[model samples]
Target: MRKMILPPPPLFSALQQPAQHLLPYKTRKKGGGGRESARSSRRPQYCRDPAVHNALYTGDLQKIKSIFKDETTANLIIDSLAEELVWSAELGLWVLAPQKTHTSPLRITVSRGYRDCVKHLLLQGADVDAIVGGKAALHDSCANHRAECTRLLLNYSANPNILSEEGLAPLHLCTTQESLPCAQMLLEYGALVNQNTRDRRASPLHVAAKHGLDDHVKLYLCYGANIGHRNREGETALNSACASADKPEEAGRYYRVVKRLLESGADAQIAGRKNHTPLHNACSNCHIRIVELLLQHGADVNVSNCAGYTPVDCALHAVEDYLEGEPEKLIATLLNHGAAPINPKMLKFCVLSPRTMEVILNTYDRILSCDSWVEFVPSEVWQEHHVFYDSALCLLNQPRALQHLARCAIRKQLGIRCHQGIAQLELPSSLQEYLSLSLEGYLK
Candidate 1:
């Protein structure tokens, strides 16, 4: 994978270096001669003059005009050296290397939103599509959200579909809400909405979904983005959105993104990396609303991922992080939707989450005989909910009451229709609550 390369800082002391030092190192005449010669030959040596560096960095129009008088000078490669900690395969350790980066006057000005300087360079016959340092001027302009510069470059015949060295098109770099206009320009100039990254095969839709960019997602869908396109990991845009819905504060945004994708005909059960469906991802992150949304859209409740874990299993595993999210609601929702009961052996994950444990336990006619879960619960949590813990332990090896058994029988007969069937039963509200495994603070 290509590491992110930061733009070069100001070149105050960089130009003071000796000219010979600025050039690519000469081939070593001794050991590893062929490899050294080939490596040196591929490195482009460019002008490192301080005056041109200042002119481009500061957006000095007249100075830029003087320095770049012709097409060759207009596209002159400016080299900057910086010490980067790079992993050395030979030594098996990280070491500092003086890395030389190359960029052109057009790239510098476009990246900084210096439109006049960019216009001057372009008028001087600067190559708008010239890829120095693995990116064209259009890539920088889009990445930095320089909409005007991006429009100017596209008008000058910059390739909107150009891919960076990292195999990402400019559309893929429109990751923020502010980059919306840049993305619009790319699409207007013939950028492929479904262009996949060379490595991950992730389209701009996947990128936008992963970042929870609802506006970008809306735009892409309108521009004919393939909603079902999967990346190398087999994740569709919906899967990407669910997997990244980790922050509770950001849940609303992700929920909207997922809802929009579903509305656009995204498959809810399409599994991705590790064969995890969007339902699995939503459950694992304890995104209750998204989980409900997915189920409403026909997401399968009992689908298993590559690890043989069902959506309920994923929810159980995430209890620790989402105790405050009312994980019991998610567990109850899954059961109501006909999800298979979680294996008794996996109950340890919910020991600290008494309400979650209660919901899972309520699914069975008889509580499974598992004493190990008690040890996993911290003493503080046990103390906080001693009544529920005590009641649960007392019933571990005992048969549930006849009333509970009847409730279980009704739920079993209803099967996947538990939610709707119970509502239609015309039972009293208290009985309905009991049938739904509503937490009563202690086992009945």
Candidate 2:
């Protein structure tokens, strides 16, 4: 292949220059030792030899030993070229251009989990802290979840807190459950447990919570991670956990993370971006268990976010996306926890979600004059759930039965304490279920 050498970007250009130019005169004048160290730290020259590339890519230990016999050879930047389609403004058409990339032997081996090759390179005096291709060998090891290589790099005195070109520390890249060991190793080697990314200001704890890595969160907490540390968006780890619990299959894992955060004294009502509390986030994702957990931890059920949306309102908006998650359970939980009855006009939001509509309707003592809900529901959905719809419409603008009236009266008297108060009453289990608005598939 033809060789294509492009000028490095400004960041790499700065890395290639001697450090003395950027330092104070007194520091620069220290000695030849400082000057030599600076020279050694400069970016290494690129190598386009196919023999060296093959030795590094295949992890050929003897071939690597023969080729990288010294520090300079081991640290030489390896160049790789590829063809990518680029839009040409002059030609007004797409054309193929040669794209050049750079990496070092240590980074290549470390990312591939070649422990033997990595040790050999490090033993040959490779710069453990060198930033090649915008990342150090340690970053590659952690990002690829190569625990053995990570341990080897750290043992060779690699800077555990080194940031990538994106300003993310090794801990920030430990986003998967499989990377938990790498994260633990980082923390044990004096990685800052609460280190924040340069751009987002999201700490390690926030990263763990956002991915629903409960064990990672537990480990970070044990290492004294700041659970309440807010990102640039002002979101605590708890808020991130709730907001990211969007997948129904992953809801349980996120629920556990949220529970751990709340148990660790996370402020349940703490608002984040857009003045949205964790409760608002949990409800908006239709995480019933998380919503209930937040409520039990004293999350304000009636709190409104920047958009003037209560938790119930957020839950209503989420009904369509989370119908399979039993969004009605979230609505019921919010109402039981003292959320004000949703505005009658907002009932349109849950019209398609029959169960959700039923829960909201059960909160009222008397059915109001609202026929527009019939029009909001799709014709096919209305036919599918005509039984529930017919029962609800029959009771519109009419007084409820004596049993429902009594249930509503008891629920109102208990107000926010409805759950505990009903449990305390000497009523039968059936009566308790009724008072709690347990659905019988239709309103009575």
Question: How would you encode candidate 2's per-residue C-alpha lDDT over 324-414 as one tens digit per residue?
Answer: 8888877887887788978888888888789888888888888876665778989999999999999988998888898988888888999
lDDT of each: 0.86, 0.84
Error of 1 at 2 (Å): 13
Task: Provide the global lDDT of candidate 1 against the true structure.
Answer: 0.86
Top candidate by TM-score:
2
For candidate 1, what is the TM-score?
0.88
lDDT of 1 by residue, 1-444 (tens): 124444555564444232343333222233322213332433333677778788898999989888788665775678777666767778887776667877878899999999999999988867666667788888899889999999998887777887888898999999888999999999999999999999999999999999999999999999999998988988999999999999999999999999999999999989999999999999999999999999999999998888899999999999999989999999999999999867888889999889998888888888767675877989999999999989988997798889889989999999999988999998899999999988888886
Off by over 4 Å in 2: 1-43, 83-97
Model 2 TM: 0.89
Q: Highest lDDT, which number? A: 1
Please give the distance, in angstroms, between residue 394's alpha carbon in candidate 1 and its true position after superposition: 1.9
